[model samples]
Target: MKIKNLSLLVAMMGGAPAIALASGYHFGSQSVSAQGTAFASGAEAADASTIFYNPAGMSRLQGTQFSGGLTFVLPNSDYSDKGSTNYLKRPTGGGDGGSFAPDIVVAPSMYLTHQINDQITAGIGMFVPYGASLDYGGDWVGRYGLTKIDLMTININPSISFKLNDHHSFGFGVSAQYMNAELDKASDAVTGLRMGAAAGAFGPASSAITNLINAGAISGAGTIKIKGNDWGYGFNLGYMYTLDENTRFGIAYRSAISQKLRGSANWDFSGVNMTSAVPGRFRVQSTAG
Candidate 1:
């Protein structure tokens, strides 16, 4: 499909917004212990969280081990309108868009690893590596652009590692990731009314439609909600080498996953239901690395 069409489809299907507080909607606090050192311990492999950072390090973990933690993200952001206009070139008047997002978000993660033998290890991990949430007041001036959005993902990784020797090790894993997303937004009432008026100039029935808009019976401030979820699979590989007793280097590669999401988009315009009488199903395929 053309890039424009695909972009439109994605936007209608609840794609992530362009502006976000985090790094590309990713919550990087996967390990509490690693946070102190700025996650520079990829090669340290001191905890079970290594199952996620680098599975090859699991071979260094003693017996069965488990690590669990929670990272609370308190994000502070707001939108300020510096003169805005609608599609009809009319000033969009509403209180300055205040707090366009939630005040706080909590993310949790867990991992388990077991040493199977002198040269082998097995591990499993559950975490959320990507997500975002934004909610703007319904009456905000920019409501037409967006009102609310929520996106979440959960990844389950199962992996195995082989200690090739005292200084080198290799690991491989498969991932099952589940993603859910929801989007809500308002349709531009003024723009819709202007279009209806233009159409009315050509036909009688169209004139009636325009009259309804002018009469406030069709205010044009419709709302659209889209919901979707999907599951995708991917793989990861890792290698670790011991440079000395206190220094080691690790490298890891994760493959991308393609997912086809299926869901329904519902529209409600002043109590008028649009999807109730039609097939509201929507499908979109996207890739995540």
Candidate 2:
């Protein structure tokens, strides 16, 4: 779907105008059969894909059944400058970020169900529930705020359903989810140099560093990249009630999964070659969250 005029507002300190851009990252359509009605048909329990929407529907399958498909996601992120400014309150330089969203994303889904008996069914499903990928390059005006980001997750669900009578069915499932993320942003080079000087790391070359910065030998820009991955656990429950053969009612709940990522933060200055003068000065730091 094409999202338009959706703005992501970032509060600017000191009254500077904020930068706005389109920002939505959840992909909810996991079943192709349910998509035409925007998933309102989930309660219909028509196929094995129900292992994802309402597992109780698995009881409706007569025998071993399988369903699989892919969903293509194409997103566009067009940025327009709204008087954006840097932390120094100077006009944020560089072009308005171009279309940074990936041209296409393939989300895959698969489900398998087997009727265990007259009243029980077992199933398993795999799907992507959340994802995002974008890259504004290195020279955009909003680089400091966020230059690039890529996040992806996969969920595996093993479920069981019980048909209690002509009208009642219940389902339960547990999930094991995996998530990975990477982010990039510009950091202030001048601030880093000042920190080094203040800590006396520059020693006798402190004044020389200031002169280089003042003479434009340094562009006062750096880049920081963060990467991480983790696994989380959750569960889902559903209940379906068949009212006559033509009518049905259903309710479902999914638990929230929390992930703590262990990763690293890598950064380096872009303009000047300071590594030769201060070997190993720019270092990668370990991080966790």
Candidate 3:
């Protein structure tokens, strides 16, 4: 194998999470070889990913084999001001503005399979099933909505396939996943609303508070940062039927797995504070961010 291949083998051994699903989570990626496709005959290819395809399907392949390739994924995203509410009622309606969206994103993938014997088949797969990203404009009304965002994951599945009859087969697979997340806080718009909102809730402080705010003494908007991650396990079951050399049907089921992402949101005096929070925000604010 090549250096790239070996390096990937090492990483797969680590069981990284994928970037798919809501909140930037993904389950798995596309398969590589035709044999890979044969076993995983349908959208539910998890089992046929190699020895992963119906193990029963492997009994069909006469010898050893290898399959590998890349998958190009184009992800488009948008983070707009559209409509929003200020918990503090700042009277500031977050306005629409220019975007800092990321360029088209392309992700890579691969898979490999081998036939062990009439009773069992062994195989390995390399693919990305999860990921995430962030690209907000500097002038975004919701800059505080989110910043410095990222998503990444890796999974390693070792599986087996077995044949049941002339055209029937069964396969199973187990996966281990590792995950991580990154976040950043945006600056405030106008210090007036951010600082004033504190007083609105308290009923009222004093000119001392106003003076402190005007003197920029109360401290403008504080920066908030968050981060955390988790791991999960799952399995796959699949079946395939052969109609002829060039015809067949496949069905596979993948169990659901849960990942708990834990992270703390914090405020920093030294970091960002947007110019204004937005519209719809009131006494909560006259102006904000």
Candidate 4:
């Protein structure tokens, strides 16, 4: 009974968070061996790849160890337009978006661990933590929502572990994360003109807005594009306890990080009348961190 209870306790301690900080965008498979078991072997002290799963596992490794792997992701998604609507609930008239997901994505990971002594181990890991890419063209029915988006992030983790006596080990790590993203969407000129008409923003030029709408000049008047990149920092902690040579327990936690993107927004209004355009199609830079 005591052994069974101990096993349960260790299992719970060693179970790392099944979900990542980035959730849907996170690439959870960092270690090839851990991935084979659905990443449930965080406390196994398996290899250098442990630098990503459970840094404390490095304490059990001897000498220098390195692990590397590449993963190929093939995603396919088809959007069936079963009556889509814009922000105003009006039917969005456009072609049904085909497969917007990428055909293939290659994600790679590398880790290196070195034993400084019998009681200390140090390692570093580089991997993709979050990424995505999709394109739906500018004329899609849901273009206003999102025509195209690309996001990528890289994480560099350096960790160290200390072995206390023979039964317990603890680990700490610092992470530097970098992310880049680009987003684009179609702007509804007709809707904006209507809103402006209701708010009396056009004043004496109100008739011109009506004329543009009547002439169908608002169909593809503009597109909004945003591009940004930023960096963030975080930390992680891990603990591993050994109960006999065959049983070990582990647990790890990664801190949440927030980054303010600094970039520019570009509005393209080439399809509309440039003479009457309110200089809305221009570049706006953000000084955010």
Error of 3 at 159 (Å): 0.9
TM-score for candidate 3, please give it.
Answer: 0.65
| Residue-wise C-alpha lDDT for candidate 4, range 117-170, written one tens digit per residue | 999999999999878888889888877677888888889999999999799999
Query: lDDT (CA) for every model shown?
Result: 0.71, 0.73, 0.49, 0.73
- Give the per-residue lDDT digits (tens) of candidate 3, residues 1-289: 0112222211221112122223653534355544345534433333334444443354455566554455444555555554554333443244443444355444455445576767666665555676776655434455445545777766666667777666877777777665666665443423333344444522354344445445654333333355666777877777778777677677767676677666553434343222232221111101111
Clashing pairs in 2: none
Best by TM-score: 4
Q: Native-vs-model 2 lDDT?
A: 0.73
Candidate 3 overall lDDT versus native: 0.49
Where model 2 places Cα greater than 4 Å from the true spot, the runs are 1-24, 194-208, 274-289
List clash counts for every candidate, in order.
Answer: 0, 0, 52, 1
Report the CA-based lDDT of candidate 1 relative to the real structure: 0.71
Best lDDT goes to which candidate? 2
Name the regions of candidate 1 deviating beyond 4 angstroms.
1-24, 200-202, 208-220, 271-289
Error of 2 at 50 (Å): 1.6
Answer with 1 or 4, whichever has the higher TM-score. Answer: 4
What is the per-residue lDDT of model 2 for residues 3-48, given as tens digits with 9 covering 90 to 100? Answer: 1221111011011222334354676777778887888786688888
What's model 4's TM-score? Answer: 0.84
The per-residue C-alpha lDDT of model 3 at residue 112 equals 54
Q: Arrange candidates by lDDT, highest first: which order?
A: 2, 4, 1, 3
Error of 3 at 232 (Å): 0.8
